[model samples]
Target chain A: MNSSSISNYINTLFPQFEPALREKLIEQVTIKDFKAGEHLMQTGQYFRSTVLIVEGRVKLYREGTDGNEFFMYYLQPGEACALSMICAAKQESSKIMGKAIEDSTILMVPITLMDDLMKQYPSWYYFVMETYRSRFEELLLVIDSIAFNGLDQRLSFYLQKQQEQLQTNELQLTHQEIASDLNSSREVISRLLKKMEQKGEIKLYRNFIELKK
Target chain B: MNSSSISNYINTLFPQFEPALREKLIEQVTIKDFKAGEHLMQTGQYFRSTVLIVEGRVKLYREGTDGNEFFMYYLQPGEACALSMICAAKQESSKIMGKAIEDSTILMVPITLMDDLMKQYPSWYYFVMETYRSRFEELLLVIDSIAFNGLDQRLSFYLQKQQEQLQTNELQLTHQEIASDLNSSREVISRLLKKMEQKGEIKLYRNFIELKK
Candidate 1:
């Protein structure tokens, strides 16, 4: 009875999923929700299920030694958390963290059924591979940004990414927020922002920065 | 005839692989060799097969904008290149670079058989998942080092990693080499090494740094 609602969510959110695989998920999966600003997963926590996002957004980041959040990537609706899948499969603790940037829903597929799904559903296996590949590539890009670029260049890339990901010219982030994400000081980020503003690349407002198109 | 040699190598290096799975690989996979310092995969290059190391070591790193290489992790015998598996499956170009740190032999498994192997062999599927999980975890650790720690701490961690991975107290790398790997200036690294020497952690020499017992 409750599964019917799950089936609806799965069908709408993951239209590309094979019918048989969706049916399998509906039979075995449970729904979980997180409010905005909630921590969905924390460092060193073990997950019992493979998580599939159904609605809203989840932000993934690494927790620094002093608990500062270093932004990594985002999880949108109709996607899976690659770390959850891997950690669940291996029964390992997570080293990173996941938080709900917006109220979000996810399908919790039990780790017990993972091997069976991989064997029985080709689409499921492909999805798993694709998720790993995409997240792996994202990490490589992050490494490249930090390894190759200076603070100014990294700021530029980060803003560009946020602009593209958020789909808006107005980025609702504070100088301190950007500083924490980039593991720099607020003063440094503010100075960089001022430089950008002077260069006509951005316009700073009270609560948001307008990216000049 | 050629397959028998491959079979022997597979058996010796990866005994944990299921017998049937190893047989399938011997029948279908081809062996490729890389001399030390040779590039196996470069930025934007596409791979024809998933690479599994059978002998020696591969160093995986990110290529910076100015072509500086930032070390990520090492791949030793009996392990598969997780990115190779992903890119080969997706028909995508590699974002990271791989080089033979030691003269290496690898088995190249054609992408066409990846699906069949996953479905037919449970152990093979597990290996694939394990490969992805391990590499993903390594990347997270790399992120943590760069994002959270200072240059001195990172260097300490790097030298410790080198000692562990090489199974020796003597590290045969120059300051310039270590600087390139850590994406830092040679002067800074040399100063840090001198500091470490003052503290009796390691002894600086012409071509190598020897750890104090």
Candidate 2:
């Protein structure tokens, strides 16, 4: 285990911070690294601190009654892990899991510290409110997609979003992962991919697929 | 129109002092009344204010690409109309129409004034935050229902929710409206209703259906 400059990186997200305040926040945050497949928090755990991804990727998922995992979304660099969970701490039963997709380091700050920061720093309060608002809007858009769009359309939308977010035309993703996000079976996804390929919508490659214009 | 004691009534939803601050909010709000089947806001116009239902009921709905209107949910007394619109004001297009379900009176609070309240009052800030959270969570549950739950189960859940929210066994709903909410066709909903009737799950009445426990 090694100490990292994660706090310095976190200050970059709060670019409006004065030098003195930035130093204080950096001193306050604690950074931790986890290996891939490690669960940061699971159902029934008390998460008193909110975590920000300093490096690497994390995925948040919910397990259904039959043990099927539903993809809520992924936490990328600069994104907070479960902002909603931190704000509304009343959820006794955790419906989602934050799993590291890669070797990841995150900066954590206590909620009480956050409260003090909001009061003492009005600009910081605006930043926190904006962060929550963005996530809230994203969740609503996801709900709209689920309500209005079909399975294939959702799969297409997800792929498009991932490609844009990752800045790559091709992704090294498995059918099972796609199925998890789409809330369908791997076999169904395989068939759909085949159909999509046949229609010249996408080109399937080894461990990746390229979208067609 | 004669001025109604709407502010006195809205105070019931909040604590005493908080409602006094909200009464100041009333001056900034316009009291608008509508009959059943009247539109408060439509798809093309910019929605500038969040309406509070002081009396009667309202429904929030959007149209599909096929020009079919999908009723999302009903807003009861003391609830906000199209609250997501308030949170995400960046939307260039209106997705839903707030229609009065019956003879309804609504207090329209402009977005700027609501933002002011959110800044001045921590209690109102928490209230708005919780309101958005509830709406977002409700939508997530809806997504879960659409993806995993069977059609019959979904229909049962919808009926149960309406019963609880509306506080009535009988719902004055049309088949087309039910189909839109369930994301199915009228024919499918009709068939399911017949099947439920045979199984004693629900009793169909004139202009309404009763969910049998």
Candidate 3:
């Protein structure tokens, strides 16, 4: 996309930005594209720039010390990873992993400009605060699910969230993948899937799960 | 405390604030005192103002639907609740609870000034983002504990954190309180404590736990 197109897209999301400030943002940001199944970021890595997802989806997950992965949330168009912004501001390393689940376009704003943007633009400050607020609330919900909800309920919630992100009831995932995301073993996930299938909640295929209407 | 003393205290924590901004913050913020065991905030309640703890400690906990409380973290004298800031900024209600664990003094900044402060003060904006980032990371750690660590290990980690916060190896809490914080039964916590005591890790008492040297 051209610079004007990028500026227009940003303005659409944050209409409060003035022309001059918007132009400055457009000038400072660089656009990058990632193919499907690409690692946008990894654990223990520092983010040189904060990313704004201009197009497509990004999956964020937390990796445990033993290499177990648990699904955290997704970043859609118009959303940025709050953790990335936080780490960028603090000059710290990320503890979570981010991957593009599909072909994605992201606007990269260098860390050097973040402070200036916040200081100069009220809209940018609001955007940053709102991002942090929403992400903080999301993390709380994730904790609630793991702390209070049963594994089966968490699995169902995970599938529902995934379907919503993918915009389809049919999910292209193996039981093992589901198990890994939920931090459960494949045998346990298979047993739960069998029970779910028996109850007609989902139809399990060789490598996919179809949520019944 | 006097206004100048409060300003001095805030300056100690956030020295980046300009003298003018610091004076503005001091002028706008009202200091409120809380008795030990007072509720600073509760679940599902709206935050009318953001609080900065000027003295003593605050215990932050998440309440489950059934009213079971899980301890999330603590807010020391220098810190503020990031959720309160977020909720205040967005005009949203809080999902967790906060209580003054000891006699405490807090500076309450009205929600009306939040935007103006962000617009006028770079230090305030940085403080807000850093708060959100640290709290977000804390929530992730909570999730890691629940998802990866066993209950016994979580209990141990909990005790260690409590001891660190209280600045005493002798924790002044009942087994029931510990169970409530960990979202387990008193019987379960008692059993685990008994095991830890046998292992010479802690000495259990009627209403307190003493960590061994």
Candidate 4:
């Protein structure tokens, strides 16, 4: 997108920003493109800049010491990673990982400008706070699912969320991929998917699962 | 404590605030006392004001639909509940519950003043952001524990955290209480406690647990 289109898109997403502040943001931000399946971030890596998703989707997950990946959530267009902003602000390293799930465009703002933006723009401060609050709530919900809900329930919920995010009933992921995302073994995920298919909740193929309403 | 002492204490705890802003906070805030076991906040309840803990400890937990309580973390003196601040700013209801773990004194700042404070005081904005960042990280850690760690390891980590927070090796809680906090059955927790005791990791007493290390 051209500079004017980018500015308009950002203004549309965060209309609370003053025109001058919006212009400043447009001037300072550098747009970066990532191909599908590219790593946007990794655990233990320092955040050099905070990102704002201008287009496409990003998958976020937490990595275990043994290289296990547990799916966290996804960031869509107009959404920024709350952890990135916070870690960038505090000069801390990331404990989670992010990847581009599709061809994506992101606006990256340098960490040096964070303090100035907060002081100069009320909209920036509000946007950051809202992002943190929503993400915090999402993390708590994830904990609730793990702590209280059964594995089957969590699997169903996970599938539903995936469908919602992809905007399709068909999910193009293998049972092994699902297992990795949920921190389960391939055999267990396969069994669960078979059970779900038997119950008519989903139809499983070789490498895809279709959710049935 | 007297008003002057309270002011001095708050100033010490949140040294980021400017003198004038601190004076304004002192003028606007009201101190409230809570006995141990008193509910500071409940799920689905609107936060009329945000709290800053001045004395004692507060326990935070998420409650399931069936009333199962999964302990999240604690708010010690000088710490504020980031959720409360965010919910107050957004005028949203709380999804987690907070209770006084001991006789506690808290300074309550009305929700109406949150906007004014954010706009007028850069220190207040920074403090809010820091609070959100730390709490977000804590939630992510909780997710890691539940998703990847074994129950026994989680129990050990939970007890260690309790000991750290209460500053005592001897924790005053029943097996049932611990089970509720961890969202496990009493039998399961009792079994784990017995195993820990057998390993010389802890000594279990009636309604109490003493860490050996």
Candidate closest to the true structure, highest TM-score = 1
Model 4 quality (TM-score): 0.95
Tens digits of per-residue lDDT, candidate 1, A1-213, equal 377879999889877789988888999999988999999999999999999998888889899878788999889988899999999998999888899989998889999999888888878888888899889989988988887888998999999999988899999999998998898999999999999999999999988999998
TM-score of each: 0.97, 0.87, 0.93, 0.95
Q: Quality of candidate 2's docking, in CAPRI categories?
A: acceptable
Worst 10 residues of 3 chain A by lDDT: A8-17
> Model 2 over residues B1-213: C-alpha lDDT tens digits?
433465565567555337556767756667878998898777666667766777888877655555656556678776765453454344344656678878988777677665567556767666665565566556556656766778888898788888887899889888877897666898999889999999998898867998877
* Candidate achieving the largest DockQ: 1
User: Model 3's DockQ?
Assistant: 0.74
User: Docking quality tier of candidate 4?
Assistant: medium
Candidate 2 global lDDT: 0.70
Inter-residue clash pairs, candidate 3: none
Better of 2 and 3 by DockQ: 3
Off by over 4 Å in 1: A1-4
Candidates sorted on lDDT, descending: 1, 4, 3, 2
lDDT of 1 by residue, B1-213 (tens): 368879998889878779998888889999988999999899999888999898899898888767888999999988999988999999998877888989998899999999888899888888888899888889988998988888999999999999989999999999999998999999999999999999999999999999987
- Individual DockQ of the candidates? 0.87, 0.41, 0.74, 0.77
lDDT of 4 at A193: 87
Residue runs of model 4 more than 4 Å from their true location after superposition: A1-16, B1-8
Q: Quick one: ranking by TM-score, best first?
A: 1, 4, 3, 2
TM-score of chain A of each: 0.96, 0.88, 0.91, 0.93
